[model samples]
Target chain A: MSALAEILFGGLFQGSLYAMMAVGLALVWTTIGVFNFSHGVFMMLGAYIAWQLVELGLPAAVAFPIAVVVMAGVGWILQASVVRPLIGRPNIVLVVVITTLAAGSLIENGALTIWGPRSKQIPALIDGNTTIGGVGVSLHQIAIIVITPLILAALWMFLNRTRLGLALRAVAQNEDASHLVGLNVTALYGLAFAIAASLAGLAGIFMGGYRFMSPVMGSDPLLKALIVVVFGGISSISGPIFAAYLIGFFEAACSYYFGLYWTPALLFGVLILTLMVRPEGIFASRSRGLA
Target chain B: MNPILTVEGITAGYGRVTVLHDISLEAGRFGNVGLFGPNGHGKTTLLRAISGLLQAKSGRIQFDGQDISGLSARAIVGTGLIHVPQGNRLFPDLSIADCMALGAYSPRARPHEAENREKVVKLFPKLAERWRQRVRTLSGGERQMVSIGTALMSHPRLLILDEPTLGLAPKIKDELCASVMDISRGGVPLIVVEQDIEFLLELTQQLYLVNHGAVATEIKPGESLDHGEIMSMYFGH
Candidate 1:
């Protein structure tokens, strides 16, 4: 494959994964009215679970759904137990900090207990190289690229067209009014968290198959997702996706020309620039910050 | 005529500070009442308390004779007590049509969404004209219409409008008053909270003069309460 094609294909595949990963974080942030720091841990848990299941002789297809479902269940339970009790409280920062501390400790210790410190490779769902338009791409990478978009399309439909989707959107837009109209706001919060966790779970499995899984592998993806959310603007569904692809392509180009080590610097620079130019993210039209 | 909605001794407040103290009122079948008070005296808070947006420290709210005191905002709204809250709380990102659809968000109202939407559109032709337009892009008056139209979609037996004319022009306020009169005539009881005495007197037959969250006085239409009494009651001498 030509260098340019490699960059394009690599960027696209990675961007899709990044977008999916960050979407979960974004949903939790917007819907639950909390900056949950434990979101990345959920992703890690998914990867770890998928790795274990694959080790037990389960097929990749079965293992993936199982991981997502587990993570979603965890998400629901967490919201019910920890997040729900703190609703209407003014201590948002405390909740966020606690989530972060709890998540980091849990992930690091949980990984040590279950999967050990050693990194594990996931057998690729599809192997070998595939060529498209004179560009060579790995079949595994192509599968991820294809799957991510399809998942996103389904999510878009779920949020926009379904009954719960409308109610969820209403709750996100105006919490008090949604309650006034008789929506179960607490239930909506749980669903939002579950959806987010499921996305992270999906990302974890995808990452495990494409690369390698470790106890602390979630940090990079979580940070990248945060960047994508910031770049796309908070609360915008399409914004993060577009920004994800852009960042992915940018990272690939930087890695190719300047070496892989320079990618982080480039991403941080882009993030800083975005913050300077548009604090609300490139997609936010009006100020949505709570007064 | 049977009372469709009743508020009995509802002592409500924010947190520990009491705003409304032992206040009570009612809306009869096909009735319209004006709740008048000065700023910060619990006019809006009463509406909030009754609509289940704010929990009363002690009280009973009977909507269709069912106790709604401890009910969730959703349940209160489900019992045909819809509150068009202060400020035009339109879902700015959603279109006018979507906002209207969300009005009937309860399970019972969900099935008749299409029919209710048709009636709402007919009532507010301006909304029909801008059905697809996002609510955030709408003018103040247009957004108010969308807000009211959304409440109407729920097919509420009692509509609680809190300061609907807060920031509108005189002509727009007049138009809004006319809309309220129309809604009242259409058989939905209205409890309109307004500072404009003329606006209230022109449309409503009964008045609850709220002072410090308590019903200080009740005035019936055709009563010879002069403007002096109204001014003192509104301004709180």
Candidate 2:
């Protein structure tokens, strides 16, 4: 029972991180129609930036926000310079996908060149562990568990209650209608990318302390994010959150009972089965059109 | 008085396929004009061009004395020209209230959003009742109401509606036309592209017949429309 409890808690913590990572991809995909193959690179960059800042003597708390801000700026510039030009052009999907993939390669190579291939450890924001129901949990895990809800709540408020967030949602629904209604579509797209990048950056910063950081660490999270978003329903914000938790719990349970090697097979199998059964996602509202 | 909008020899189209050729028209303040023609004769294309969805290959489109030929759809809406597109191009999963709120997205329209919402709700009380409902679930007539109501939320100076009554029952169509006439009477000019000739004649003071991507004729107010002649023209008989 204690072992089960520990796995459940760990799973929840990991799921929340996946939620944070996936939400950005979902937002960008639904709004901008860009799959953003480069999103993982942004996450990697965030981890690196936070790590470098800590190396320069800044505290983890300060380094995290700074990295997020930098990532937001990077997102804005990338969308404006690369993605905006290709919008409304013929074969836009092909162009954007190729451009973003190229950008990801460039970022990865740049990181490799600068930081070398060596892996680095990030100092934890907190030290010590607490016992819950006879299971020991690290302070970092607890922080992640607590912080994820706060972030989700903040994001929910921003999306539903704020004007800019409302505009972003509107654009996501129908770009043409948004423009006819007088929304600055270009600015909204840029804002969406910036927000998405910042969220990914936040996840990266948190994970930097949670686990060892490497130049290629982003690929796994990126794949997990894609899975969560697809399984959750691309159009629904809360859907990915729900799916992330499910995947996280399933993986944890599988790893605990079976083995770590079986976890990937089980996860992918579940994803495939879910896609076949409910392509719109487990949490997706039936009324929502294609994302 | 200067016209609220003027299109002087505007030529526009999709890439390599000219849908409108040298289209010129003008609308006075609070004037209601109807574009009457068969389907695929560029009536919708003309509306799209005026709303800045399609770029003009040549000529000028002036709105309220400002040259707005090259302005984007977003900028055009800022000038108080709102287009309620055909086929109910609404966000299917969004609540009717959210759809209405999004209509007031421009900075210029934001201040008047509440008042406009009130006006729209009053105009279409059905929409008010289903404010929380997703647009996809609404009936055709209800969706049309939402589309028009959404456009009204923008506080438009010139409202362009494309086939607003399409796929609606006769009774609902009559009510919608009445509401549209009410809207026009409330000091907003309208350029409507509709297939219902009786509704068009009842609602508009002037009509333009477009054919082969050009303005073929203008039927002035008080002139009798030769129904057979118009039918033959539309059917290419």
Candidate 3:
């Protein structure tokens, strides 16, 4: 039925956004050995930046890219000031968790204060809807579905083919050896954060195109991204991506059949079962491999 | 002429536990030196400090006439000191070919990437056959070959190997020793640490006995004592 296609397409569309956020989360986790708790806030900030730019009369095309660039800078700054300082300490992991969690809270509260908690939305990049097989679909949804895979492929190529990406992978695998092999590891860490932020920012822009985004809108997606990253192996880029879409489809199906209210419970139940069976992860590699 | 690399009265260690105490050693312009000692006696720590993974708390390190006591590990590697650390510590997920490319990541080594890669493949032809294999899948000896080959791709002016043949079958160890000899014959200097006195005697011109985190004795391997005598000397038997 066309209704089936609609759900599938809807799942794929939402899955694309989840993939973007989770991939970034996974990259930062592997690189810095710290799970950036502010990752979701970065998404919220990106949507806000794009909204502000559009408010200043910049078109969606210009605003989205500018927001991504700005988010890259913000990511680098976050790593430098917030993350980099705490590396090599005795209790770095614990310290970083607390610090980043506090930083996320501060940024969220600050955004709330500045943006006034008003729900804002960006006009869709292309303002049109079309029916395919008697199921109505928005053009932006199709665009998101098409665009995400290409971006992920580009990322894969960068990681597997380029020398810089090789260095990032190397750092993730054995940081000491990466430095011993003459990599500028600090710079690579900064790059990982920057790239992750850009990806998260794009996800935010895509989200704003479809739904009203408030400062707190990121928390839900953040939780979803966490699930995706865990479901996928955090050690590799492609793992989180596949898991993201799979989770997205699961969410859609559960919402449709089990009712929206029961979706969360079912998701958590399945996640718990999956973990109980395979505590490492669903896509876990035997050894850490960033690519 | 000044020695190629010199450590003058260096004191270094991990956090709060001092290991190398007032250790001083030097390598000639174009000769291999060996260090042998009991386990946990600071040979690896000395290599770590010399390679810039650890800082000398109370002395100076000069490499090719440049003062390099407190330089970062990357900087030291850029200065053409390549260390293939102990225990095949490598990025297990990377393919052998990828490891070779990454070894030449420093600007100083980039220019020589092509020839160095050729040399590594030629030195360890087994590595060439499994260019796309992940390091984790490789056998122990094969991983060691990849580690050393990866180091060779760095165009090292000075190559340091910590227990290059620590654990392997005798036949594989022989092949590795021959390959290392070939590397040395090709004119790259070596600072090797090993437990096999026969291997050390064959490889190094001079040997330093490290004990209690200091150089306890310096002996020319082919000079006065036999290999058994030297082993006893190192073990303090």
When superposed on Cα atoms, how far off is each prediction in RMSD? Answer: 2.4, 1.9, 1.4
**Runs with alpha carbons beyond 4 Å of true place in candidate 3:** B221-224
- How many angstroms is residue B213 displaced in model 3 relative to the true structure, after the best TM-score fit? 1.1
Q: List the residue pairs that clash in candidate 2.
A: none
lDDT of 2 by residue, A227-289 (tens): 898888887678888888888888788888988998888888988998999998888876433
Question: Model 3, range B12-86, lDDT digits (tens) per residue?
Answer: 988899999999989864379999989999999999999888887889999999988899999999999989999
Q: What would the DockQ be for model 1?
A: 0.63
DockQ for all candidate structures vs. native: 0.63, 0.72, 0.85
State the lDDT at A155 in candidate 1.
Answer: 85
In the order shown, the chain A TM-scores of the predictions are 0.93, 0.95, 0.97
Best by DockQ: 3
C-alpha TM-scores of all predictions: 0.94, 0.96, 0.97
DockQ order of candidates, top first: 3, 2, 1
Clash count of each predicted structure: 1, 0, 0
**CA lDDT of each candidate?**
0.82, 0.85, 0.89
Query: How far off is model 3, as Cα RMSD?
Result: 1.4
The candidate maximizing lDDT is 3
In terms of docking quality, model 3 is high
Better DockQ candidate (2, 3) = 3
TM-score rank, highest first?
Answer: 3, 2, 1
Q: lDDT tens digits, residues A171-241, model 3?
A: 99998788889999999999999999899888998899999999888899999998887777787878889
Instruction: Please report, as a residue range, the 10-residue window in candidate 2 chain A with the lowest summed lDDT.
Output: A282-291
